[model samples]
Target: MLGDRFVYVAISTILAFSYYILPQKNEHYPTCPTVEIYRPLNYSENKDILDKIINDETFRNSSLYKMQQAIRINTTSFNDDLPLDVGNNLDKFQHFTKFHNFLKDEFKLVYENLQLNMVNHFGLVYIWEGSNTSMKPLLLMAHQDTSPINLKTLNQWIHEPLSGDYDGKYLYGRGSGDCKNLLIGHLEAIEELIKIGFKPRRTVILSYGFDEEISGFRNENPKFIENIYGPNSMYAIVDEGGVSLMNVGETKLAVVGTAEKGYLDLSISIEKQGGHSSIVDKRTAIGIMGQLIVEIDNNEMPTYFIDKNPTFYQYVCLAENSIDIDTKLKNDIFNSQIDQNANENVRNFINKDKYTAYAIKTSQAIDIINGGEKINALPEYVELMINSRVAVEENITIAYNKFVKDTTNIAERYNLGLNVQMAYSDEIIEVIPATEMGKLTIKPITMLEPSPITPIGDKHWEIFAGSIKHLYEELAYPDSKVVVTPGLGTGNTDTKHYWNLSDHIYRYRPGVLPSVNANSHGVNEYIEFDSHLQIIAFTFEYIQSVDALDD
Candidate 1:
């Protein structure tokens, strides 16, 4: 009789796990509506205008040379590996004064004409006052900082990371691609326009902030942003979020970021007691943590392949004709677009493209871990750090509640007493027993929800679509016309702070040159000099296009 009862319970447990892990029936997905986007038929006259601007032999050569000079500066925030720099380390940002001086010299035309002010010297803002002050201003933004270079991989780079070596085709350096390129592109465009004796009809604001790479991102120039372009005063704001160009297979696509994913850091801890490793227990602290990790991993937060809500998938679905995905997969997307029970085949299909898969779901990665001290001693405490990108369909509150419930179930399965409960705020620390809950505790280290999704129907979307279309057309690549799509950025940008002032927030960097060896934080970061020029072209067109907007 006892054996039969144990077997019955075992079968029930297996079935329960199977039901949670593979909820194959809950295929019902929210549907993100597709915007009516049309591909360009003929290259616009704006391309001709941009070509004329770049055709200036004298201006083009000098501007490219000066851009290389700008990249050569050691304007980095830290020395590779050694974060804390002592006296006279030029790259440790003591050279910032020199960098600023170089900018002032290189863009002499900009300073001589445009009114400029330093936001405490750390943040740089340049204002070109338009003739029509009544028109809402356009703000262009890019970060001034870059990630710290890794010393262990320093020798692996083709050129010195700070050398800004231009190898006739590519400009190689730390900040070359991650951001500095965009900043220089904007600056170069303005400088050249000034040389051409061009004056704007509407105000143009350029903002460069520090601390984008740091953990605690503190903006150095709020007052400047306030006094110039205050709340509800700006028409549109652009920042680096997504690539202006991306190629899935044979087809080239121009992607503009309309939304950014939210972030959350969870530290899962399971504590018991420490003893000699030889003294075996039914389950150790590490064992409990393992079970919890497995539970979360196996029963990952449900991902949406299709549903009623608007998602980036809608854009991908529209581009289905362009992408090289299988026809069956495309059919699966449509079949499950509205059903509560979406086809599992569709989920499997979309998840195949790691890039597109993430935009549709909340992602979690276990990044950090801490536990035992010595091999001989058993671990009483185990902690794991999970970094999650919250999806638009879910909030931190809802997602975290699920996490707690999952933890509870997992704990109950192990027959472990979980005296501790989870709370989401700040970093987690190991402590002696305090409250009487049980053995497990989960807490959030950091939490930030996804950014608001900008509407594709707005005038800002039209301007973005137009500017990107023109920019891509001028590239003359992909052996055919490019398709434009609204995308959700997997990462966050400084534009998050500007959400209050502008609703039409866009995150995109103009032109992405496809490369097998791409590294945003690793060795040999670089960008094609021509790709840099495209940003300037896009900036010119975007401003021109928006200037036509009725106030």
Candidate 2:
């Protein structure tokens, strides 16, 4: 009997250890076809093409200097005086005029040839007319604005967010790496390309949207570009998104966004009898709101990856390199049958990595909740703002429905009045009578569906990949190898609105590394001066090569 008891305790201990203590990462396994380092047989340029930009020491220094100046100016989006549907984020269009004039002064060659149009008196569009009308134009995009920094966090920065300080190695500011690197880097290349008499046979358009950080109430910039370029006329649109390249231990991957997830905001409000805090009951508005949060937290919709190629996450898992996989891990991913246990392991593995999990399923976060105006008062109302990013397999309607069903159940359990909007429309979908009337209300403040996937089977992919090859060969990891693969952006970018204009949209933030803690779109955002130079070099080659492609 004692022996039986000991065995039972031992088994319990083993199960607990496996469930709680084991590492979430499992990169050692692979059926990954995209794991190999890609090498092209032919060269896009005579290898000397990279020299034109690399050799121009004076030009390179000037470009980086100009970038620093650009960052110093605050283009932070504000609730400005503009029409709501236009989605103007700038405090005023006048704020962008100085930066526009600055660019014109710095890159003389660019403004001279390209017809620089100041859109809506705030946004910018630079046109470089191509010789061939037969070929669609190539578009490069990035944003001019960034997220507003809190005044309270000013001292927390190593360098002030607006100071635009270059600390010997990094150019520091709010928008440095997020989009400015590409934004300025491309312009730098164009200025130099024109100086060297490198003319693009294919029309090249550079779009700088004023508001990309907040994801406008309307996709203003993309729509404007679409109208000018004509619907679906773009050969390709390159924008900032996802990890352009990632480094995992010894293995490196050149990442590109072939598709991106969409997002929406869900607002829930609850009201009850108002009184002093001392008279609080078992179910005040705040108390009921707290429980609802708990239920939502405990009942997150499980991620399903049963179908082999249902989502991009599965495709990435299958395409992962064999060399990265060990025998045991390989068996676990492949030999294991498509059972509940196997699927559970895969789901856990994905959720462990911050990036891959988002690619697999829709995610939720309760970002904002407000109740009493005063602490002492028995709060009469509470509102919760939920931000959800939907996966490619799901739609906005389905995700919104699930939210309604879940929240409704919560309201019923608490016997509270529940009001919620099922979607983006003005009509309120549900009104559950609570202890008080108008006690609860939930509505969607925003909604954007996931983008369509742009497959990689054309010369466009090759030319883009070829650009990576040329840049990496001369620049990237000397020892660590890189495999270029198709990836879906877990978050959206300026490219979101440009989707209809092109069948092929590639989001690659050039001069960025595949590393954690990149500090993008966060405090202490910075970019390596060297990477910026290489990006400029890469852009020069990418456009010149595309110009050579057959019609």
Best candidate according to TM-score: 2
Model 2: per-residue Cα lDDT over 1-551, one tens digit each: 99999999999999766643332234433233332222323234434545545555675567668888888877777645357444354445457667777777877888889987766656788889999988888889888887788888787889889777876667888777766777888998887678668777899999888777767533365667777767998888888765655665445567777888778778877777788888767777788888878877787765755432224333444335435433334334552334457556656776787667876788888888888889788887688889898877788887877787777877777676676666757776547655643356777778899887775746777778656755765555455456666676777787777778988998776665532245766677778766777778778777877777756
> What does the lDDT read for residue 172 in candidate 2?
84
* Per-model TM-score on C-alpha atoms: 0.80, 0.86
Best-fitting candidate, scored by lDDT: 2
lDDT of predicted model 2? 0.70
lDDT of 1 by residue, 1-551 (tens): 99999999999999876643432222454233233332232225444546754555565566577666777776666424433222334334556677678879878887887777776546688888888889988889987777787789877988998887887678888878868878888888787567556677788888887656653144545456777667778778888866556665666666677788788877677777788999957767787788888888887777764432234454443435444655544444555644434457666655778776777788878777888888999997888888888877778877777777767777677655543334554544333233222367777667787787777755667667756765665443423566666777776778876777677778888766532234666799888777777778777666666665667
lDDT of each: 0.68, 0.70
